[model samples]
Target chain A: MKTILESIALTKIFKTGKIEVTAVRDVSLKVPEGEFIAIMGPSGCGKSTLLHLLGGLATPTSGRVLVDGEEISSGKDAVRTDIRRRKIGFVFQRFNLLPTLSAQGNLEIAQEIHRNGSRDRQHVDEILNLLGLEKKTHHKPSELSGGEQQRLAIARAVINRPAILLADEPTGNLDTRNSMVVLKMIQELNRALSQTILMITHNPEAAGIANRLIEMRDGRIVSQQQEGEWNAAEDRMSL
Target chain B: MSSQLILSNVVSRPMRSLATALAVGVEVALILLLVGLSTGMIRENSKRMSGVGADIVLQPPNSSLVLAASTGAMSVKIADLVSGIEGVKAVAPVYLQLNTSGGLGLVWGIDQESFNGITQGFVYREGRGFQGPDDVIVDDIYADARELRLGEEITLMNRSFRIAGIVEHGKGSRLFIPLGTMQRLVGTPGQATMMMIKCHDKSDIPGVKAELEGRLKSYPIFDMSSFAAHLEEANRDFGPIKFFTRTVVFIATLIGFFIIFLSMYTAITERTHEIGILKSLGAPQGYISLLFLKEALVLGGLGFVLGLGLTFGGRFFFQLLMPTLQHQLPPEWLLYTGILALFSASLGALYPALRAARQDPIEALAYE
Candidate 1:
């Protein structure tokens, strides 16, 4: 498999009124095409910050991030924006849907921006159906359940067929049942469509659905396990 | 999609959008109504001046073109001298008094036979003109406005006068009294404000004007064409009224600017997270800015239409309140006012839009 995303010696530091905090230390990682990878850590371990750096949503303090062989970490904002619209999609924990727009409107806006004002209605309907949100396309975010809203958010993310999908705590706010449903859909996307995905979560069960699991501690990747190895490890831990 | 977003945002907050649009509408209506009144008044005055049917107007030196501003400066004897000039057919001595009883109006005191000769005659809508010194011949507009009937007594200049006739408008002042009576009331016996001169043939007007210029040195002589132009020029300046109109325009522009600025600014503050979502979706800065501007454009367009409605409404209201007041709705002015409203709204939204566009996506996303 080809490496679709690569981060080299990534570091991130945040400053507030002369107080500096190191969020992420020098860490390097690579994601291959069609792989489902999850990063697991406790709160405040810089998992989200690392994901942001990889997605080009934030500039690293000292590092380089490459998306599909293009350097995006040091690119201009316009260049980064172009790359993001063309090749990257982001799903946030909060759903981050425009409240004023309906579910279909939310997806259309993303497609509009990605395609520079052109839309593919067929693709949009397909994505809506795939997410099981076809009947609720006209419903506003507020009118949708937690699982439905998150599904709508995911549909919006992949509506334009971006090269890679970055999901930050995709099911953090959902109940166990909904979380399983969302995780299963994500797993199906990777299996059926070969869509590359990077997810961050605190739930080991959610991480269990991924082909690979990377555990972080203090901004460093302390351990990496394949699906079989992580499953066996989880069974032993439960014992 | 952008349009849908803009519409949804505006519809989402009905009261704010409506109030902002109403403010813009009021600004536009003020400009149209003020400009309309002044322009209409000028046109009406010019029409009446032309309707006098005089080939030339001879005024006392230093007298104003506005008859209402003229005093009894020259003696009525000037009419006789001009009538004696070659090609001179008739001359009417007119003593003008500015009446301020009910409103600011001009009262023309005229010599009945000569005034009739120069004007061909007043087109009487009711009765005869000037039956006595205390009888006033009002124009039809004035009669209808005041709800007066023929032979009804009305007080003017602190003196009672009967309505001898209601003549068609556009021949001269709305109220006409005998020249001798006006001269006596003002204590300026034999004095006239100006003389309206007619020529035997229209071709002889230029000759008569030149003759008067040579024969009556230092006196102001204007042929009908120049007189009409002068009236239009005076109307254009309109002195104090012109100043007032400009002041209103300046204030209206500022009001429009501040109203849109505050509205957009508040909207931007409220939509920070939405803006962040757009930014994260790969929306360029210009797109985000354009979204806000399009919203303002919609508001301005609605406001412009509403402004026109308010303008016509105001015109009708004023017509009922003051019948003699004239109003004109020039199409060019309507277009300019529409442009002005849109420009003010766009200008007002510029800062907020750019500010919203420049927001950091990360910080904006984190905004609670």
Candidate 2:
């Protein structure tokens, strides 16, 4: 499979006053086309930072990243923004829907940002239906339940049909039932729609749905296993 | 869809939006009211002066186009010279005094017969014109405003005069007294403020005016058309009032600017996480900036409508209280003020919008 996203020795160091902390150090990874990969680690092990670097949300300190063969890490802000707009969709753990906008409005804003003339009513409806959010189209984020809000967030992220979906703890705030529903929807997106997905999670059951699992420790990937070799025991051990 | 987002945001915070809009509305109302009063007086005075039906007008040298400021410096004998011109049919020499007691007003002193000749006579509602030295003729507006009946006494120049007649308005000054009495009272026995000349033929005015100008080289002279143009230009360049209006406009814009800035700044702070979500959804800086700008514009639009309502309401109430006061709303200033207010609001939102756009997505997402 073709490599859709690649990070070469990615490193990120944050500075506060005179002190510096390395959040991510010398991490290299590649994601193939149409693959669902999960990165599991402890809270401070830089899993989220790695996802941000790959998604063009943050610049690497001493490395490079490319999405779909285009270098995003070294590009100008506008160039990187354009690449992100065209190729990447992000789902956050908090289900960051604009509280003022309805579910449909949230989806429309993403399409508006992407500016694809393909944001026809039919396509928006299709995405809402696919996320089981068709009934809550007019509901604002505060009006929707946890599962529904997360589903709406997912619908907003993929409304423009981006090349890759980067989900950061998408089910972290949901109950077990809602978490399962959200994870199943994500898994369905990857299996049925052939979506390229990279998810970060602390739940082994959530990671079990991915085609591949990568475990991280101290800002570096410590293990990579295929779907058949995925081990919940090893994930807990690494933590 | 973007518009929906903007509308939702504005509607979401109704009180803040209303408060900001009220500030902008007051800004707009301030410009409208102040400018209206000044321009209204100018236009009203100009209209009445022109309606006196003079073919040619002559003012004392160095006198302003503002009739209220006219000084009785020119000799009444200048009207004699003016009457001698070939096309001259009649000449009315009028003395004027500015009254600044209870309110600003102008008192006109006119020779009744000559004044009546130029204006074809006032339409009298009661009594007669300047029947005695102590008699005063007031227009119907002044009569109604002062609630004075015919033969009622009104004080002028510290002397009481009986209201001899109340005539229809639109001729000249609201209060008129005999020229001899006005001249004597002011201690300028031979002087007049201005000379209103009527020509025998309408086509002879230019020739008559030229002749008068040639003869009285030291006086300021004009035909009616030129006189109107001069007043219009003077109105445009009227310094003190212009400065006052501009200062008010500047202050109003500043008020609008600060209010919008604070409103948008607070909104940005509150919506930090939403901005992060938008940025993550690949919204460019321009898009984010435009969102806030559109919201400000919406507020400005609402404020404009509110301002207009306040202005008209203010005018109605003011006129109800002071029946004699004339208030004119210039049509063009409405559009200019609206555009200026919106532009100011956009400028106000600029800093906050740019700050929102420049926010680090990661940091913003982590913002609690």
Candidate 3:
């Protein structure tokens, strides 16, 4: 399988006046096409920062990141923007949906940006149905429930069928029931549609649904585990 | 869709948007009034000078034109020298003095026979035109303004004068009297402010003007075709009303600029998180900047239309309410004012738009 994403010793440093803080340090990683991977860590461990670097949302201070074999770490803003638009879809913990737009309008914004005003209604209906948002299509974010709004956001994120989905704590604001629903929907998108996903989360249950898991601590990757081996590792760690 | 977003944003806060637009509207209305009054004054002054139906107007070398008349004293004898010019058919030496009624008033002193023969477009609406030494013809504006009836004596310049006739407006001065009476009253007998000359043929104006200029080399001369230029040049010496119109327009633009700047900046601050989300969605910097510009443009367009309506309607009521004041707003000025309002609002929005566009996606998303 072709590697869809690769980050070689990627490091990100943020400068605040006289102090320099490293958010991601010497992190090397790779994911094949159609793989679903989860990064698990405590808060402030730079998992989100690592996801940001891989998704072209932020540039690394050192090393390189490649998406579909094209180098993006050193690309200029416009090129990085183009990559993000055409290849990556992001979902935030807060949903980040425009409140003024209906679920349909929000989906249309993504659709229009992807093809410059060309839209496939059937494709949109399919995504909405897949996310169980068909009935809530015309509802604004304010009118939708927490789970419905998150689903609408997921629908918006995938409406363009981008190559990769980068979700950062997508269920952080949801209740346990809604969190399970969103996680199940994400797993369905990966398993049924062969979609590639990279999610940052603190939930072990959420991590268990992914095909592979990477654990991070102090801005560095500590271990990588496959789903087949994850159960045994969890058992041994608990012991 | 982007423009639609801007529209939705505007509609979301109707009062703030309207207040901003109304502020701009006030500026537009003020600009319209200022331009209207000043241009009207300039045009009316030129009209009065040209309305004497004169082929040439001769004044002292340095005489300046006030709003409705010439200033800087000169010899009334210029009429004698100018009347001898080759094509000169008639001469009228006009004595102009500013008088006060309720507003700035122009009083013209003319010899009835000569001034009336050369002047056209004047017809009495009631009574007669200038008969007795103390008799005067007042335009409808002044008559209606002072509520003077025919044969009513009104004190002017501390001298009592009877209103013999009330001529229609636009004929000339608000007040007219006999030349000798005014000359004596002003204590400048045999002196005139300017001389009006009529040629036998209107086409012979160039020849008449050349002849006058040759004999009266020290005097400033004017003809019908070059009247605006001449008045403007003469006005240079009198010190134009630099503050009345230009200053008002400058202040109006400044007000419009600051209003839009502060309003848009506040709006951007309020929508910082939205801007960040848009950026994270892969919206280009240009796209983000364009959203703010579109907002301002829509606001400006709204303000411009409102201002135009108010200016026209307000001026109508004002002109109707105050018969003494003349308010004439030309179409070109109306169009210019509309453009200025729009342009000022857009210009004011530029800095805020740039600031919004430059906001980082991460910071904006986290903004409160």
Residues A1-239 of candidate 2: C-alpha lDDT, one tens digit per residue: 99999999999999999999898989988899999999999989999999999999888888999899999897466777888999999999999888888888888878878984235777888988888888888888899999999998888777777788999999999998898889888888898888999999998888888889999998999999988786563443211
Report the poorest 10 consecutive residues by lDDT, candidate 2 chain A.
Answer: A230-239
For model 3 the interface RMSD, in Å, equals 1.3
**Candidate 2: Cα lDDT at B25:** 91
Per-residue C-alpha lDDT of model 1 across residues B46-85, encoded as one tens digit per residue: 8888899999998888887766666537988888788888
Q: For model 3, how does the per-residue alpha-carbon lDDT over B172-204 read when each residue is reduced to its tens digit?
A: 567889999999988999888877778899888
Residue-wise lDDT of candidate 1 within A1-239, one digit each (tens)? 89999999999999998999888898899899999899998899999999888887788999999999988788477777778888898999999999999988999999899989998888888999999999998998999999999999989988887788999999999997888788888888888989999999988877877889998988888899887886545542221
lDDT of 2 by residue, B182-282 (tens): 99999999788889999999999889977877877878888887787788668757777678788889999999999999999999999998888888888
Considering only N, C-alpha and C atoms within 3 Å, which residue pairs clash in candidate 2? Answer: none
A1-239, model 3: which lDDT tens digit per residue?
Answer: 98888999999999999899999999999988899999998899999889889987788999898888777787586777677778888889999988877777787777766675566778877888878888887777999988888888888888777788889998899998899889888888898888899988887878878889999998999999987787644532110
Give me the runs in candidate 3 sitting further than 4 Å from their true place: A13-22, A115-138, A232-239, B48-56, B65-69, B77-90, B120-122, B131-135, B151-161, B198-239, B242-244
Off by over 4 Å in 1: A231-239, B66-72, B125-127, B131-135, B149-164, B184-188, B217-220
Off by over 4 Å in 2: A116-118, A233-239, B157-160
Candidate 2 CAPRI category: medium
Locate the minimum summed-lDDT window of 10 residues in model 2 chain B: B64-73
